[model samples]
Target chain A: MDKVIIAQNLSLAYSKDETIINKANFSIDSGSFVFVTGASGSGKSTLLKSLYGALKPIEGSLVVGGVELCGISSKKLNFLRRHLGIVFQDYKLVKEWTIEKNIMLPLIINGYEKSITQSQVDSLLKHVKLQHQAGKYPLELSGGEQQRVAMARALAHNPILILADEPTGNLDDYSSQLIWNLLEGAHEQLKTTVIVVTHHIPETIKIDYKHYHIEFGDIHEVV
Target chain B: MKSFKNHISLVIALVSILFSLQVFTIVERSIDAYKENLAQNYSLVVVSQKTLQKKELLDKITTLASIEQLSPDNVIKKLNTGISKKNKELLKVTLPKFYKLQLKIYPTPLQLQRLQKELLRYPYIVKVETFSNTHDTTYKLLLLFKNVIFILSLSIVLVTILLIFKELRIWQFKHNERMSIMGLFGAPAWLRSAVLFRLAIVDALIAFGISFVIFSYFSSSAWVSEQFANIGISVIVFDKVYDSLIMLGVSMTVSVLLASFIVLGHKEEV
Candidate 1:
């Protein structure tokens, strides 16, 4: 399998003299479900940010979806981000837009036809079980429902890689299970690579997956 | 209510700026037309020691429109009636030539001085009366009026632009979150700030419409027509088609440019 993400001596920092994720080396295979576990402030979120091009590497090489992210121009990074779906912990939905419009964001940015985008949004609404709430705004939805909307949005574009930064971190047990099922289902059905960063991994997941734990600013795979 | 407030603020600023511009244009046109009227009635009296040829005078002074010889019979009649008819004839023959010089356009004070110097360069053309006292007073007053209007209009435009820019910046702040979210989704800069552009364009159109109606009404008013009649000059206060196009262009350009500034500033902050 081809590697979707490759990091050799990747170091990420918000500023100089304050390195967050130290010279970490890792490679995530295509169509694999991987969990990055770490304690609070262990640079788990920073590592995920580097993968999605939100944070650039201060020292070494970090590539995602076959594009080198270190020193990448904003224009090129934006183009690369179009093919990758990202879900944030806070559910960064445009509050003024309706749920349908929020889910349609990725498709609209990709320049998909309006008719096709509408149908895809409709289908995703049904899949996410928010079909009845398509016209409501993000604030009108509950936390779980909003996260489900975020999940639906992340999976809407059929991206090659999906990066979730604590997607289910603030959700209830049932909501967390629902999010996990979506990630697993995407990997199985669409053959998409999934990288999720969280403090704990739910043992209920039955699929074969790889685990990488972050400790002492280094990422180590756990057998 | 908040959106209405925003629209009203921008419209008010734009209307004030457009009003100042219209007033400036009207005042300028009126002054120019008045000057033309004055120039038509004004003439220079030139006394020459030798007979002055019309073609020669025109060639010497390019601004000379027409030169008509002043009949010396009237001045001669006012002289002593006891003089013999032959003496009168001799006096007329020996008298210097008198010519009225009318210019094609009104000359500025400096141009008038230059014309005087040019005319005096011919020794035979000794006495040239330009009526400098009256001409200076009228021309100076007209110039001062034009300069005052220009400075006032420029100041109003500058202040209104700053107000519009401030309003747009506030609007951008309100929409920053939405724009930032769109940015995260790989939306281009234009798409991210589409809302700002839309608001600016809509407000600009509204302002243009309001300004057009106001100017059109004022231009055709009876009072405005009477004022122009009193001044004895016909001035075009507004040209519906031409002025409308200019106003539209100016309002759109100002609003769009200010909105673009806000968008770019926000982008830099991000």
Candidate 2:
């Protein structure tokens, strides 16, 4: 299997005085589903941020899709981001835009034609079961609906990898089950590499997935 | 409707500034035309013992456009009302030579004084009367009016520019989150800022159109035309095409520059 992300002795930190992840080592193979579980403030989010070039590594090597995260230029970072999808815990959907436009954002940024972008957005709307709410703004939708819209947006451009941070953390049981099923479907059907950050991993997940736990700034694969 | 209300204050501020500027330009031109009309009718009376050539007078007073020698027939005719022919002839011979000295333009009080002193240097010249009292008062009043308009226009422009900038900054803040999300999605800087530029362009056009209509109506108004006629000078209140083009340019430039400033500031913070 090809390695999509490789981190050797990576040190993540917000500032030089405070380190979040010290000497962390991890590698994620292509087309694999993985879960990162940790307690509050255990540096799970920081490690995910470093993978997308949001947080810089204070020390050691970290690479995503052959691009180094540490000391990356803004132009190079943007280029790297084009090949990845990120789902924030708060949904991060543009409040002023309609749900359909929000789903089309990544496709537009990737320079897809208007016809293609429209069709893609329409398909994603159906996939997320929000076809009726396509014309509504993000603020008009429920938390579950908004999160599903964000997920559809993340998958709009068919990116090589998707990094979801606590996607089901704030959802109800019904929305959580729907999101988990969507992630499983994307991983199994489309063969997309997915790394989800959460405090709990559901035991009912039937697909094969690797689990990593973080504690006291140390990352270890549990199974 | 909310967006329109949000942008209305900025549009009004821009329009006020632009209208003041247009009024200032029109008033300045009108005053210039009035000054030229005054110059055409104004001249000084000079008495000289010796016959003076126009060229020699011009050499001595560079400000003098021409000198016209006045005939003594008017004085002779007045004295002849009750006198004999010989006495009238003698009165004519004794009368001093008078010449009307025309000026190229209306002179400032200081320039008039300098001209008087320069004329006094000639041994043959005796009296020079410029009617300084009336000319000085008129000139001073015109200058005071022009300065007041200029200062008022400047104040309006300065205040409105600050207001426009503040309004634009608010708009920028309102749109910053959306722009940042676009940036994270790999949108280019220009793409992220497209909405701001569009807003600027649209507002500029609206302000330009409003100002153009108002000025056009003023230019054709009876009161405006009557005011210029009263001063004995015909002035164009505004040049429709040329002046509007200039106003359009100013409106667009100010709006675009302010929008760019806000966008650049947002980028730096992000």
Candidate 3:
């Protein structure tokens, strides 16, 4: 399988004088559903952020989708992001748009035709069982419902890699299971690479997968 | 392809405000000029040699509070010098110092007409006449300059409105940057900026429309007609549709591009 992400001696930090993830190294395969588990401020989200191109590496090399994040053209980074789907802990859906519009946003940005985008959005909305709530706004929906909509949106463009930051953090057990099931569905069907940052990974091991828990400010694959 | 009339109307309102200011100023200046010219040109001229009759006419004139006393010798010299009136105002003719005997008056054309008839009825007044003549190219030149000043004033007003719009757009740029809030589902910068420029064009058209109406109102007034006589007042309104269209296109293009850049450069919320 092709390497979807690579980090070599990747030191991530907010400032020059400090290093949060000190010279870390990691790689994610194209079809892996990897979970990054750590305590609060253990650099779990920061590591995930570096994999995409939000924060730059302070001292080392990092690459995503063949585009070097440490020193890459902004255009190429945008292109890489087009193939990448990201979900924040907060959902980040525009409150003004309907659930259907929200779901089709990525496809629209990727410049898909309206009819095809609608079909894709329809199937995804039905897959997440949000067909009745398609016309509703983000604030109008419950947290579980909103998360499902977000999941659908992330998968709308059918990206090769999907990153989620504590997706089920604030959800109840039932909602958490539902979100995990949605991810599992996407991963299994598309063979899509999935990287999830979570502190609840130990209890979330419902499926066999590789796990990395933060210790001493670095990712160490649990034995 | 929205007919920018709406935006143009709004711009017209802003421009009209400026033009109205210029109009008020022009009216005041024109009034001042009228007053100044009346004061400079007015006098009790006795065109007859009947000394006693001249005295009686002068006496009758003094009875009216609006009239003043006059000297016989002074009156005779002025009536004789009337033949060389053009050269006298030219300040090059060797006319006697009776030019200093002139008195000032601020009367409406009706009042002046009455005065002309009253003075003409006097036997001492040979042929009562007014020196406010189109043949006096000096006054004509001054009138031309006055009109030019008004045109320049209107032009300044227009430029000021355009400048204000520019300033507002600058503020818009900073606002978008500071907010860093994306418009919505991948809407590009041009669509956002186009909304703003369309508003500006509407404003310009609105201002021009209102100014044209008010200016037309003043132009049609009887008083204004008397002031700006046919062929005497050179009112060449320098407004060609194509010229304005070219300016509008350039400004709209520039504003659209500026808004696009500003929106695109804005910091997106993390």
Candidate 4:
């Protein structure tokens, strides 16, 4: 299988003197479900940021979906990001927009036709079990329901890679299980590479997956 | 209700700007029309030793509208009867040719002085009467009025434009989160800020409509017509098509430019 992400001596930082992740090297194969676990401030989220072009590499090289993330132009970065879906812990949905519209964000950005986008949103709404609350705003929904909306949005565009940064961090048991099932479903059915940043991995996942643990600015795979 | 309240500040700013601009146009046009009225009645009388050619005189003084030689019969008739027909004929012959010089437009006191000097340059021209005392007072007052109105209108326009920009920036800040989310999704800058531009355009149209109605009512008001009549000049206070187009253009340009500035600032921050 082709490598979906390759990092060689990668370093991530927010400022000049403070390096978060230093000289880390790793690669993940296409269509693999991978979990990145680390302590708070171990740079797990920073690593995921680099994969989606939110954070640039301060040193060395990082590549995702066949595009280099280091020193990338905004236009090229946007193009790369279009092929990737990102889920945040806080569920960054436009609150003013309806949940249905929130799920339609990716498709709209991808320039999908209205008819197709609406149909896809309708099906995704049913899949996320929020079909009854299509016209409601994000704030009107519960935390779990909102995260499910965010999940449905991430999977809406059929991205090549999905990056989830503690997607189920604040959700309840049912919501967390549903999120896991959705992520697994996308990985298996769509052949999408999934990289999730979390502190723990659930024991209920029934699939072959890889695990990389970040410690002291270094990433190493666990057997 | 909330959306209507949001549009208030921008709409007010646009209205003040457009209203000031229209007032400036009206004042300028009224002054011009009044000057036209004055030019019709204003003329200079010149006594010359020799007959003057219109073309040659025009070459020297370009403002000359028309020159007509004043017949001397009236003055000759006014003379005493002690002068016989032969003497009267000789008196008329010796008298300098009287010519009235009208100008194409009303001249300022300084321009009239310059014209007097230019006319006296020719040895054949003896005396020129410009009635400067009366002309000076009226022209000075008109000029002062025009200057005052121009400064007032300009100041209003500048301050209102600043306020409009501030209001637009506030609107942009309110929508910043939405725009940033769109940007993260690979939407281009223009597409992400489309909401700001749309709001600007919509507010501009509202301002334009309000301005048009206000000016239209003011233009047709009987009091406004009476005031123009009192001044003895006809001024076009509002032109429906032309003025509307200008107001629309100005409001659209200012709102869009301010919105674009806000969008650029947000982009830089991100």
Best by lDDT: 4
Taken over the whole model, the C-alpha lDDT of each candidate is: 0.89, 0.87, 0.65, 0.91
Q: Where does candidate 4 stray beyond 4 Å?
A: B69-97, B268-270
For candidate 1, lDDT tens digit of each residue in B1-270? 746886899889989988999999999999999999999999999999988878987997899899989999988999967989999999999999898999998989898999999888888998999999999999999999999999999999999988877887777776787877777777888888888899889999999999999989988999999999998999888899999999999899988987887787775222
Better of 2 and 4 by lDDT: 4
How many pairs of residues in model 4 come into backbone collision? 0
Chain B: TM-scores of all predictions: 0.94, 0.88, 0.36, 0.91
lDDT at B138, model 2: 92
Candidate 3 clash figure, as a count: 22
> Per-model i-RMS in Å?
2.5, 2.6, 5.2, 2.2
lDDT of 4: 0.91
* Candidate 2: regions farther than 4 A off: B55-66, B74-94, B118-123, B267-270
Query: By DockQ thresholds, what CAPRI class is model 4?
Result: medium
lDDT of 3 by residue, B1-270 (tens): 234532443354365444645454555455455555645555544344333343454466542333333434544455664556565444423322221124444444555567668866756446554554522444456557767767776676677557656655664654453232222223344433544555554555455555555655765567766664542442322233633454445445444554444555566543
TM-score of each: 0.89, 0.91, 0.60, 0.91
- Evaluated at residue B207, the lDDT of candidate 2 is 91
In the range B10-57, model 2's lDDT, one tens digit per residue, is 689879978999999998998999888988999998888877878877
lDDT of 1 at B46: 93
User: Sort by TM-score, best first: what order?
Assistant: 2, 4, 1, 3
Query: Which digits, one per residue and each the tens of the lDDT, describe model 1 over residues A11-90?
Result: 88898988888898999999999999989999998898888777778899998989999888878887887888889999
Candidate 3: list runs displaced more than 4 Å.
A172-174, A202-205, B1-261, B268-270
Better of 1 and 3 by TM-score: 1
Model 4 deviation from native, Cα RMSD in Å: 2.6
